[model samples]
Target: MPTSATLAQPAAKPASRRGFLASAAAPLIVPGSALGLNGAVAASDRITMAAIGQGPRGQFVLGHFLEQKDVRMVAVCDCFAERRAAAKQVVDKHYGNSDCAVYRLHERVLERKDIDAILTAGGDRWHAVMSVLASRAGKDVYCEKPISLTIAEGRSLIEATRKNKTVWQCGTQRRSNPTWKFVVDVVQKGRIGALRAVTTSFGEGPWRQTGVPTEEPAPDPEVFDYDRWLGQAPWEPYSKLRVRLWRVNWATGAGAIADMGAHYFEAVQWARGNLLELPVEYDGAGMFLKKPGINNIPYFYNVRARYRDGMLLIMDPAPKGVRYDGEEGYIHILDDGRVEASPKSILEGLPDLSKLPPPKGHWNIMAPHIRDFLDAVRSRGTTVSNPEAAHASHVIVHAANICLRLGRPVKWD
Candidate 1:
């Protein structure tokens, strides 16, 4: 739903052996001013990092990492030649250094022992694989969600990160929103009284990439790496719309249910503190757009996820926000940045975190979430949205998709 007000502001592939080794091993030297004592704050303790996937989203995240002092962009990798060069240009211009390397294969970037962490967005299907490989490479990971294409993949991602003992962050950045967090506290802290059910409204269809033609076109494998872009996902012919925004492409993503659902779902998981488990059942129905029209992804969906506690999560397409109904009253967190309640007094009486400090406005929603990840990378502490929690949220959304596709309710363990 891109429900976070901050997100309302705006809006990759792999590589080879010798080529990979050379590209990944590129220099990640940190400036002396950023050096601190025990961890990344100090000169020698700086975090040398690589960015995988150089699309708009990839570059968007790289923009965030670039502004941080103690972190170095050692290398940039992507399937697209233009993106690879563009990302490197941004980094080089910022640092006034040409040491940053660009690579077609992310494997080489991972192989580099010099990199301490990675900020990656390698598409939905490649998420688990990219993260798992990075974890195994002894690097901390900041991955965009939905974290996996399937429940099994999510499980594997969790296990891999746990085994590797690496810091992991799921890019459900709304965890940093004070108002969102306050609403969750209101629900869980009994301020709402005897919670009954939760309702989520997210826009349907990520609407295929714009300016795309009606038919598939000849792909340039050399420049775009079509095969690598599709990766292990169900194969589809090269289409202009596919890679532009995989979140809307069924071959690469699970549609809007998983796209916008990732953010709104995390709000539910956070409020209920149900990040480690999924609902007991799923009942969903949706109609998809005709293939070759506005992309093959589904266009509309209404799903109900029933929890073990008899709480129902009603998901719809609209308005884009989370609503909680309790015996006493209902609290609605609207995407328009307003917190409404049946009894305005309820919210009026409750203390909002606005006064706590730092101020909440614009600030690019990912700032706090990314900040949390960086801090954890230093302290080795748990992140607000850890892999376990992220996986659980992904499972709920994926299960909803499964239910929609099957045209029947599903039983969840």
Candidate 2:
């Protein structure tokens, strides 16, 4: 890994997998939920669980964990009272147990010894804090995407999880899917031929920042724990735009980079060998297009990450969609479907895809990822996309945001 003027310490070489695992070893402090299972039961054995930030994404995570038979929904937490109660109701209906506790603050949930694992689906700002707090409290964590707002925060989250000996998974569910895995395998194996470039396009772009319009405030305004919500960031007054669409504002979010760029940037890096300490250079921009009902400028965005090895990664939201180009041919991955090289003998020239196991069902992937974390709790196996990998992807996205904001090509340090 290399570092540039703006980046952190020069990227250090990573230890071997074995060395990394040995270094991660630490004493485990089992939560009550994990201990109560007695280590003698199967998936049928009950494992109590809790959720923090039970908003839209939070509820979805709760549902995923509930799919495992051994897991029992034990607690739900959220700053928003309405959302918290809604998640609690869902948990009760699924578990048929109304006794499960619900809390307005996440710290109370973390303090509970009965909770085995925590699903941290709070806003982007809360992602790293909740994960670090939960891990310290002896709970496995399944935190949602973009893991952190900045590269520094991501590094801290990864280190804290290792120190606490927590089995953690960043919620990039696509990583659990087989088709995407197959795509990555193809790119890594040079099936696409000396991978020269990758281009990713997210769905248009998010709303842009315009000062909020004045309006009468609600009577019982949802008094969000602004200080707690701000956590590491400075505390400030609440606004509809900040509360509803914070991603566009830098103070609360990383705009599209931390939001959408996280997904495609990760896909690109996973396809490549690894992320560079810094890119050779970066260039991109956000413009507002005059589309009906759309107020933001530059609804479209694109970035080109030039690498030292001549390999290029282009991220753009365009009509042409996502594609990877190589010396021999290219692969196009689109919403409708995937199309590999059409040249005769291309499939024949590749390694035996048939030898690998076929993809599991859609819902099956997350279950296995969850099981992988659980197994690692005892066996200490490496997670598929550990915090290190997540952080690397986050760094790339962070750079992209810098370019979009400055409206100038950024030179990586």
Candidate 3:
């Protein structure tokens, strides 16, 4: 889960991409400059990459980039010493390159001129600031899902990226998966016949927290700055789960809705024709499957979104798994390691790549996402989960949270 962080400082005005391109095109430095080997830095050369957050998802993203020979892990950043250490080990084990820098502060990583882009899995609160700041620092960014904490934040990120002309990619990898994309395309093209409703489910609900150890000593102030970690949200005692597992907290993360629902809601938008077009309203509830822990929140969350066009979307925690119901037929989108589509007929004669596109090698599909970002960076083109599409998807998750908070289905205007 991406943890929110306080902004270290406002962003610097980014150098124009055209200026960078012109500088590269000209032989100002000849073959060797301060960094050395100017001509050697071809477009096909290894891209210097960094990982800003090394939690589960962040580590997963790091693993994806390691598979490609054209990329190198030059740096990593994480607030938690343990997570940082874990990520560094993974980098060392997987990266073909021998030496890489690791830092506790993301700002330090952003300051490196050699790093071409960053793989960010920071807390939800940090999404906008980290992404925007990275863009301003002249680095491409591939940040995780639920792109923003608030509607304003989402819009701000878009503006920041546009202003900086950064290559921004969101962690909505399903967009790149051929199978999922086909499902979405079919739904939108009326293969489902007047798509009336779409539903999604995930999670066993929030984990009930046990009381924190009353006398547990705080982590070394030098290693992990607690104040910096809290950022914008109200302060609270640092619990293991609270700091590392911050996704369970409303202040730091979006609970299960923002954590898992972001993916589902984004898919919902993709299925319906409202991804770019906003929704009519969000109606939902965040209720507990168990008692709240140090961070009180619903372990299980359910929601139903109604669009103005009368299309309804229902999503609940995967009852041990997930499936989709369509107007013409139903599709089973599962979490039980099972991948089955509706009417088997849809994929009967589909080609190998068309049907399964190479299992991203990891259960998590973000690897292909990393590859897509690298490709887009070279092509100077938009990726499947571009910033705009991601921004729209985030609104679905944000609206869902708002509806639950307000205890009413607020209209989307």
TM-score of each: 0.84, 0.78, 0.80
lDDT ranking from best candidate downward: 1, 3, 2
lDDT for 1 in candidate 3 is 27
lDDT of 1 by residue, 195-257 (tens): 889999885445534345345775676588988888887666677755565666556776677
Candidate 2 lDDT over 1-413, as tens digits, reads: 32121131245587998988876795667554445454424533566678888778778777878887567777777777788779889988985668567676676777766677887888788888888888889888878887887778888898998898887877776565556666677677776688788777666555544555233343242445545555566655555544665655566666654665565666677777674344668887777534332133344577888888887878776633357788887776553334455453455655555553443343234676676665665566667667877777788888777787689998876
Model 3, span 1-413: residue lDDT tens: 22212132344578899988987899764333223254333334677788987878788778888887677777778877788778878877774344566677777888777788898887788777789889999889999876777888889888887888788898877666656665666666655467677666666654444344233457885577676677667877766656755666677876666666666666777776556877777777776535335555666567887778777777677653334556776555554334466677654544553346443342366566778899988777877777788888778778877777777778888
- Which residue pairs collide, candidate 1? 1-260, 14-105, 15-105, 20-108, 35-41, 35-42, 35-43, 36-41, 36-42
CA RMSD per model (angstroms)? 9.3, 13.3, 8.6
Poorest stretch of ten by lDDT in candidate 1: 3-12
On TM-score, the candidate that comes out on top is 1
The lDDT leader among the candidates is 1
**CA error at residue 228 for candidate 3, angstroms:** 3.0
Candidate 2 local Cα displacement, residue 253, angstroms: 2.1
| Cα TM-score of candidate 3 | 0.80
Residue 44, candidate 3: Cα error in Å is: 7.1
lDDT of 1 at 160: 93
Candidate 3, poorest ten consecutive residues by summed lDDT: 1-10
Determine the backbone clash count of candidate 3.
12
lDDT of 1 at 73: 82
